[model samples]
Target: MSNALRVLMAQQNFLVGDIPGNTQKVIDGANQARMQQADVVMFPELALTGYPPEDLLLRPSLETRVGQALQRLCDEVRDIYLVVGYPRMRDGKLYNMAGVIHNGQLLGEYAKQCLPNYQVFDEKRYFSEGDQPLVVPINGVPVALTVCEDIWHPGPALQAREAGAQLMLNINASPFHIDKPRHRTELLRERARQAGCPILYVNMVGGQDELVFDGGSKVVDVAGELLFSGDHFQEADYLVEFDSASGRLSCAHPSEPHPTLEQSVYNALVLGVRDYVNKNGFKGVVLGLSGGIDSALTLAVAVDALGAERVEAVMMPFRYTSSMSLEDAEAEANTLGVQYDVISIEPMFDTFMGQLADQFEGTARDTTEENLQARCRGVLLMAISNKKGYLVLTTGNKSEMAVGYSTLYGDMAGGFDVLKDVPKTLVYRLSNYRNSISPVIPQRVIDRPPSAELAPDQTDQDSLPDYDVLDRILELYVECDYSADAIIAEGFDETDVKRVIWLVDINEYKRRQAPVGVRITQRGFGRDRRYPITSGWKAGV
Candidate 1:
C-alpha cells in the first residue's frame, strides 16, 4: 500500500450557467494537477455549473448538459483522480453530487447530505437531501466525501468516521461575509476532531452578482491544526501531501495569517467589481465623483479593480456643489490616473425648473428641487454610459440605502452599486484603509463629513443620525432582526430607534430598485434579506 498521497485543491472561479466553459476548466485543471504529480484533484461544489445557478437549475436541459459535461471530463481528463461537484438526477429527483473519476471511468458519487435553504440558499427548492455517506479508496487510503454544508453539522463527519474514512474532503461554493473565514476555521477544527481524520476543504472564488466567494481553501490535520490556507479572493491550485502511516497531512508552507477586517472586506469589494465588470463584458465603469467619501472610495476601488485606464470619473457640479468638492474630485481622479471630466448641471437644472414652473406654482420648494439636481447628473452619467458602453456605478452606501436617503432613478441609476452593503461609518474606515495602502483618496475626503452635495451646506447628519450610532442601530434592527424596543434596550435613544426603523421599513421600495452591489455582511439589502414592501408589520417589542 502506498504510504503517502498528494492532493491538489482546485480553488477556481466559475461563470454561472456555462456548463461547457466550466467543463473545460475542470479538464484543464485536472491536466495541470497531473503535471504536478497529484494523486487526486478536488474541485469546489457545483463546479460544473457554478454555485447558486438559481432558476437555471430548473431548465429542462440541466440533466442533459450536466451529463454531457461529466462525459467530457471523463473523456478528456486522464491519469489523475478527479473529485468534482455537479448536479445529478436519479429517480426523478435532483441531487447536489460529487463524483470520483479515474482513468476515463466514473468510480463513485456522493449526494450532498445537508441542503441549505436559508439566506441566499434555496437548495430545498430543487435538490433532495442525500442520506448516505460516500467513502472512496484513493491510493490505498479510504477518503470520505462531503458537500459544502455537510461539514457544518456533526452528523456528516461522525458518519464518515463510522464508515472507516482515514481522510475527508469537503468541496464548497461558499460565499463571503464578514468573519466568515474565522468561523470556517473554527468549524473545520471541530469537524476534523470529530471525524478523526485530516480534512482538506476547497472553495470557489469570484463574484456572482451580489455574492463574493473569498477562496481561502484550507487543510487541517486530524487534530484540527490548520496546515495551509490559500490566499483570499484569488484562484490558485495548492498541493498537500498526506502521510498514510501517520494519518497526517503536510504542506510546503505554513498557514497564511488571516487578514484584518478592513483588508478582507476591501479585497472582497475589489474582486466583486472586477469579476462583475469583466465577466459581463463591460467596456469599463464610470461613476459620479461628488468629492464625497462614498464616490471617492468607489473610484479608488474601481481603479484598483479594473485599473485606471478602464475607469472614468465625472464630476457634475451644481450650485450646491462646493469648490472643495470640485477640487477634491479632480484631485482624486488625477491621483488614480483615470480620465476625469467636468460637466456642469446648471443648464439642465435651469431647464427642468423652467419646465416645472407652472406645475410648481406657489408650492414651497423642499426636496423636489434637490432631487431634480440629482436627476440631471444621473441623466448625464447614463448618457455617457450609453455612448461609451461603460457601466455606470452607483455610490450609495448601506446606511443611506437603509433609510431611503437615495433618490431613485437619480443617484441609483447605475448598473452596479459598489458600496451597496457598506455602512457610512464603514465607508470612512474603508477610505482610510485604502489610503493606508497607497493614499489614493484625498485626506479631506475622509475627514470631511459626508454629504449628498444636492443642497447647500448640507451634511448627512442633517437628515439622519450620526453614522456610528446609525450603523449600530442598523446592525441590531436590520441584520439582527431586533425590534425597536430591543434596539432601545441596546442603549440607543428610543426616539432614534423608532425613527430609524420607520425609515428602513418605508424605504424598502427604494432598496428594491437599487443596483446590485458587493455584499460583505451577514444581512445585506440583497438576496440575503427579503421583506415584503407593503407589509403592515410595524416596529414593536
Candidate 2:
C-alpha cells in the first residue's frame, strides 16, 4: 500500500431527471481524477439523480433508469475508485445510498442515517433511514462513508470511529442559505474533533428549484483544523493528498472567500437563475424593469446569470411614471448592454379604466386606479414572454411579497421571482454592490426614493413603514417566527409590530400566486413557508 492517498472532489452541477447526462458527468469526473493520478474521486449526494429529485423518486421507471445509469458509469470509468451518491431500493425500503465502485464492480454501500425533514427538505417522505455505517479499504486505508444529513448528527461519526475508520467522507447535496457555509464548517470541525478522524465534506453546487447549493466543501483534521476549502457558488475538480502515515490531508491550494455578503448573495442568485433556466430548457429570461429598486436588482441578477445577451428588460411605464424613472431605466439598460424595450401602458391603462368605469361608480380614484396601471404593465411583460419564448422574471422582494404589498398577477406575473426571498434592506445592499462592480446601475437609481410609480408621487413609504424599520420587524416576526408580542418586546413599537404581523398573516393568498424565487434565507416565501390563506387569526400585540 502506498503511504499517500490522493482524492478528487468533483464539484459539478447535474440536471435533474437527465439520467444519461448525469451519468456522463460522473464518468467525466472520474476520468479527470484518474488523469490527476487520484486513487479515489468523491461526488455530491444524489449526483446520479440530481439533488432534491422530489417526487421523481416515486416512479419505478425513474429508479430503474438511475440504476442502469450507475451501472453504465461503473463500466465506463475503470481503475479509479468512485464514491457516487444515488437512490437505492433494497429489500422493501428505499435508501439514499452511496456506492463504492472499483474496476467495474460494486465494493460496498452505506445509506444516509439522518434524514432532514425541516426547511426545504422532505427526505423522510421518500427515503427510509439506514442504521448501519460502512467503512471500506481503499489502498489499504480504511475510509468511512456517510450521506448528506448523516454527518449532521453524532451517531454516524461515532459509528465510523468505532469501526476503525481512519478518515470520514461525507457526500452531501446540502442547500445554501445565508451563513450556511460558516455553520457547516463549524459543525464539520466539531464532528472531526469528536470522531478523532480527518473528515472530508463534499457538497453539491448549483441551483435546484428554489434552493441553491453553494459548494464550499472542505476537509478538517482530527484537531478540527481546516485543511482545504473549495470555492462557493462555482464548480471545480481538484485533488487532495492524505498522508496515511500521519493521517494529514491537504489541498494543493486554499479557496478564496467571497468578497462581501452582497457579492456572495449576488453570485448565488446568478447561479440559481442560470441553472434553473438551463436545466429547465429555457433559452432566456424577460423581466419588467419598472425603474424601481426591485426590478433594477432583478435585471442585474438576470444579466449576470444568463449573460446580457440572454436577458431582455422592458420598461412599461404608465402616465404616472416620473420622467427621471424613465431616464434611469434607460441608463441602467444601456449600462448592462442588454436588449431593452419601452412598452408604454397608457393605451392598456385607458382601456381597463374605460371598461371598469361603469362598474367602479362612485369609488373616486383610489387603489383600483393604481392597480390598473400595474396590471397593464403585467400584460405587456407577459405578452412579450409569450411571443418570444422567454421566461418572465418577476421582481418583487420578500418584504413586499410577505405583506401583500404587491398586486397579484400584476408585477408578480412571471415564471421566476429573483428577489422573492430578499428583503428591502438587502435589495439596497445588493444594488450598491452591483454598482460597485462597474457602476452599471446609475447613482440616481440608488439615491432616489423608492416607489412603485403606479400613481403620481407614489412612494413605498406612503403605504408601508420605512424599509429599515419594517425589515427589522419582518426579520423578527417572519424569519425568527416571533410572535407579535415577542416582536414588540424586542424594542419595536406595539402598533408597528401588530401591523407588520397582521399584514404577513393576511397576505398568504397573494404569495401563493407569486412566482417562485431563489431561496437565500432559512425561510423563504415558498414551500418552506406554508400558511393558511383564509385564516382569521389576528396578532394580539
Candidate 3:
C-alpha cells in the first residue's frame, strides 16, 4: 500500500487523424512523467486520433493504424502507467475508448457512456456507448476511468463510487465556447461530491479548424473545491501528488488566474486563425484593411497569431473611401508592423459599370454599384492570393451575416472568415482588449461610426439598428431562438423586431455559402446552429 501517488496531467494539442504522430506524443509524455518520478501520466480524450476524428474514423484502414499506434504506446511507456484515449473497433462496432498501459502490457479499458449529438458534437455518429463501469487496480489502489462525455451525466460518476474506486480519471477534448469553463467546473464539482472522491480532468488544448480547445484542466475535492488548474489555451504537463490513504490531493503549484472574457475570446480568435493557416499549409494570410472596427480587429488577431511577417494588409479604396479611412488604415498597419498595400477600386468599378451599360439601360443604380465596389476588392484580393499564395481572410461579422447585409462573392468571398460567428458588439470589445495590450489600433477608428464606405456619407445605422440594440436582439432571436412577437413583447419596438427577424430569416441562403469562422458563442453559425435555406416557417408568437 502506497501512501502517496503522483500524477502527471499531459494537457496537449493533437492534429486529427495523425495516428503515428499522436502515438509518439503519448510515448514522449510517458517518458517525461517517468523522468519526473510520477507514478502515472494521463492524456486528453482521443489523443491518439485527435478530437472528433470526424469522417476519418470511417476509413477502412483506421483500425489497423490505431492498433499499431497502441502497440507503439505500450512498447515505449516503461516506468509510468500511461492512460490514453483512442477510437476502437470491436465486434463490428466503433467506440470511443480509453486504456491503461504499463511495461508493454495493456491493463483495463473503459468506453464512453454518453454520446453527445448536440451543438458542436456528433459523437453518436462514430461511437457506441458502454453500459458497464471499469475500475482497475494500480499500486494497491482502486482507480476508475471514463472518457469525454462519460462524466457529463451522473450515472458513470456515481457508478464508479459504488464500484469501490477511490480515484477517478476523466479525459476530454472539449472545445471552447463562452462561459464553458465555468459550466464544466460546476458539473465536475457536483460529480466529485457525488463520488465522494477527488477527480482529475485532463482536457485538450489548441485550435482545430474553427474550434479552439482551451485546456484549463483541473481537479476538485469531494467538497467541490478546486485543487488547481492548468494554464488556459496552453499545452503543458503539471504534477499532482495524492494521498490515497487520507483521500487528499494537491497540486505542487498554485493555479493561474482565470482569464477575462475579453482575453479568452481574443485568445480563441488568435489560436483559431494560427492553426487554420499553419496546419493547412498556407504561406500566410491577406485581408482587406478598412478603417472600420471589424477589419482593424481582424488585422490585430492575424498579426498576433501568425506574426507581422506572415500577415499582409491591403486597403482597396474607392471614391467613397474617406481620407480618414486611408490614414487610419495605414496607421494601424504600421503600428502592428504588418505589410501594407493600397489599391484603388475606382477603375474596376468603372469598367464593370461601362461593360454593363447596355444591359442596365432600363434600371437605376442602387446597391449594384456598392456591391461592385466590394466585388472588385474581393477579386483583387483573390488574385493576390493566387499570385502570392496567401489565403484571403474575410472580415464580415455575425451581425451583418445574420441579415442580408453582406455582399455575396464580394465581402463574403475569401478562404476563411475571422469574425463570421462573432457578433458586432464582441468585435468592438475585442478591439478594445487588443488595444489595451499596447494601443495599436488608431484611437479615432474605434471612436468613429462604423460604415461600409461604399457610398457617400453612408453609415451602418442608415439602414440597420444600433449595434448595442441589434446585438441583443440577435442574441434573443438568433442565439436563443426567440420569435419576433416574443422579442417585441420584451419592450422592443415591433417594427424593429419584425425587421430584424425578417432579415435573419430571409438570409439563410447567404449564410449557407459564408466562409467558416471561429464559434465563440453557445450557438454560432455553421456547425453549432443549422437552419434550412428554403423554410416556409414564419417568426411569430
Candidate 4:
C-alpha cells in the first residue's frame, strides 16, 4: 500500500446551465492536478451543473445534459481520479450525486445522504435523500465522499468512519454570510474529531445570483486541527498531502484574514457584480449618484467591480438639491475616473408637477412632491441604462430599505442593489475605508449631513433616528432577530426599539420589490428574511 497520497481541492467557479463550460472547468482542474502528480482531485458540489441549479433540475433535458457532461468529464480526465458533482435522475427520482471517476471510467457514485431545506436551500424539493453511505478505495486509500449538506449531519461521517474509510472528502457550494468561515471551520474540526479521518472540505467560490460563495476551502486532521485553508471570495486550487501510514495530512497555509467587515463586504459585492455582469454578458453598470453616501459607496464598488471605464455615474439633481451636493458628487466621479453626466431633473419634475397641479389643490404637497423628484431621476437613469446596455445599480442601504425610506420604482429601480444588506452606518464606514485607500469619495460626502434633497432643508434625521442609534436597533431586530420587548430588555429605550422594529415590519412590501444585493450579514433583507408583507403580528413592546 502507498504510504503517501496526494489530493487536490478545486475551488473553482461554475456558471449555471453552462453544462459544457462547467464540464471544461472540472476537466481543467483535473488536468492541473495530474500535472502536479496528484492522485485525486475533488471539485465543489454540483460542479458539473453549477451549484444550486435551483429550478433547473426540474427540466428533464437539463438533467440529461448534466449526465452527459459528467460522463464526458470522466472520459476526458483519465490520468487522475476525479470527484465531480451533478444532478442524477434514476428510477424517475432525482438525486444529488457525486461521481468518482478514474482511468476514463466511472468507478463509483454517491448520492448526498442529507438534504438541506431551509434558508436559501431547497434541496429536498429537488432530490431524494440517500440511505446508504459510499466508501470507495482510491490507490489503496479508503475514501468516503459526501456532498454539501451531507457532512453537516453526523450520520454520514460516522457511517463512513464505521465503514473503515481512511479519509473523507466533502464538497460544498456554501453561501457566505458574515463570519460564516469561522463557523464552518469549527464544524469541520468537530466532524474531523468524530470521524477520526483527515477531512478535505472543498467549497465553491463565486457569486451565483443573490448567493455569494466564499471559497476558504479547508482540510483538517483527525484530531480536529486545521491543516490548511484556501482564500475567501476567490478561486483557489490547493493540494493536500496525506501520509497514509502515519495518517497525517498537511497543505499550504491559509490566507490572511479579511481586514475588516467592510473590506469583506466590499469584496463580496465586487465579485457579485462582476459575475452577474460578465456571466450574463452585460456591458457595464449605470447608477444615479445622488451625492449621498449610499450612491457614492455604490459607485466606488461598481468602479472596483467593472472598472472605471465600464461604470457611469450620473447626477440627477432636482430644484432642491444643494450646490455642495453637486460639487461633492462631481469630485467623487472625478476621483473614480469614471464617465460622469449631469442630467438635471428640473424639466421632468416640472412636467410631472404641471400634470399634478389640479389634483394637488386639496392635498397640501406632502410626500407626493418628494416622490416626483425621485421618479424623474429614476426615469432618466433607466433611459441611460436602456440605451447604453448598462445594468442600473440601486444605491439604497439596508437601514433605508428596512424602513421604506426609499421610494419604490424610483431610486430603487435598478438591476442590482449593491448595498442592500449594508446599513447606513456601515455605508459611512465603507465610504471612509474606500477613501482611505484612494480618496475617491470627497471628504465632504462622508462628513456632510445625508439627505434626499427632495424638499427644502431636508435631512435624513428628520424622518429616521441618528444612524448610530438606528443601526444598533436594526442590528438587534434584524440580525439578532429580537422582538421589540427583547430589544428593550437588552437595555435599549423601549420607544426607540419599537419605532425601529415597527418601520422594519411595516416596510416588507417595499423590500419585496427591491433589487437583490450581496448578503454580508446573517439576516439580510433577501432570502434570509421572509416576513409577510401583510402581517398584523408586531412585537408589542
How does each model score on lDDT? 0.93, 0.87, 0.90, 0.87
Over 4 Å off in model 2, which ranges? none
lDDT of 1 by residue, 185-248 (tens): 9999999999999999999999999999999999999999888888899998999999888876
Q: Rank candidates, lDDT, best first.
A: 1, 3, 2, 4
Between candidates 3 and 4, the one scoring higher on TM-score is: 3
Screening candidate 1 with a backbone cut-off below 3 angstroms (N, C-alpha, C), the clashing residue pairs are none
> What tens digits encode model 2's per-residue C-alpha lDDT throughout 1-541?
4468898888888888777889998998899899899999999999988988999999979768977987897789898999999998999888999999999899999989999999899999999999998999988888999988887899999999999988888899999888888888889999998787998888999998899999988888999987778899989876888988888787876666633678778888999999988888888999988777788888999998888999998998777888888998899899899999998889878877788888988887788777777787788888888898889999989899878998877888889988989999999999898888788877788888899887778788998889999999988877888888888778888887788788899888888888888999888898798888888666663
Instruction: Quote model 1's TM-score.
Output: 0.99
Compared with the true structure, model 2 gives a TM-score of 0.98
State residue 33's C-alpha deviation in candidate 1, in Å.
0.4
Model 3 is weakest, by summed lDDT over 10 consecutive residues, at 250-259
The most accurate candidate by TM-score is 1
lDDT of 3 by residue, 342-451 (tens): 99999888989999999999998799889989999999999999998999999999999998789999989898899988899888888899988999889899899999
lDDT of 4: 0.87
| Candidate closer to the true structure by lDDT (higher is better), 1 or 4 | 1
Error of 3 at 6 (Å): 1.0
Total clashing pairs for each candidate: 0, 0, 0, 0
What is the full ranking by TM-score, best candidate first? 1, 3, 2, 4
Error of 4 at 149 (Å): 2.1
What is the lDDT for 146 in model 3? 89
